[model samples]
Target: MQNEGEWEAVRLLSTAARLVRREVDNRLRELGLTQERVTVLRVLAGDGPMKRAELARRLRVTAQTLGTSLVTMTRQGLVGELPPAAEGGARRVVDISEHGRRMLGRADEIEQVGFSADIRPELRRELVSLIHDLEVHRAGASASL
Candidate 1:
């Protein structure tokens, strides 16, 4: 039901997203971090400690996927699991460590230098608005289902 222009736009957006992700991942690899891991760290830095289930939900990934990432992060000492806030609680809380915060700060600087320079300010704002609108619509559609 979409026109050629619409299809082209979708393709361009998908390709651009993948390219950006690849570039960011490549840069982060030097620091032994991935974009996903940085995202988790950023969320934890901003939101404080959170239950694994809640973190998984916010990340829009399955618990198992997040758990796998957490396992690696834990072993690396980038994150730590906290004891349950209440006895017999099923949820495990995860918090970013001081090292994680340092890494996240470095990641932010890297991203700013690597990513922000490529996009014009106006275009970046427009893209952000478009993505926000799409997310809002997607959430509404999901809620209706």
Candidate 2:
């Protein structure tokens, strides 16, 4: 029972998200950073050191996916992992290195510049609000299934 208007809304949102993601990814690539790596850095910066499983949950990705992402980030020196305790050895915890904090600050600057240049300053708040609402609804819809 979907109408043309509904379908158009879906397409518009999908396309806009893809375009935004592509621009961000392209910019990060210039800095030798991947989307997942940037996300890892942001999460660590915000939350501090956390267990691998918890990180995977927060990122809404599989543990294996996170493992692979972390390997690349670790190689890039953006993050570091701590060894298990000699006692009840738990999973490796992750933390952003000092270098990562510097890079993240740089990334934020780049993102702000890109957004200002490409997106209308006036629509920025509404666009952010729309994306947030979509995510909240999507999560609720998924859980109801």
Judged by whole-model lDDT over C-alpha atoms, candidate 2 comes out at 0.85
Q: Lowest summed-lDDT stretch of 10 residues in model 1?
A: 1-10
Q: Rate the local accuracy (lDDT) of all candidates.
A: 0.91, 0.85
| Per-model TM-score on C-alpha atoms | 0.82, 0.76
Give a tens-digit lDDT track for model 1, residues 1-145.
7654757777978878898999988999999999999999999999999999999999989999999999999988899988875667655899999999999999998998896468998999999899899999999999999
Number of clashes in model 2? Answer: 0
Worst 10 residues of 2 by lDDT: 114-123
Q: Give the residue spans of candidate 2 off by over 4 A.
A: 1-7, 116-145
Task: Please give, for residues 1-145, the per-residue lDDT of candidate 2 as tens digits.
Answer: 8654767777877777788888888998888886678888999999999999999999989999999988988888889997788887776899999988988987888787874357776677888898799899999999999
Best by TM-score: 1
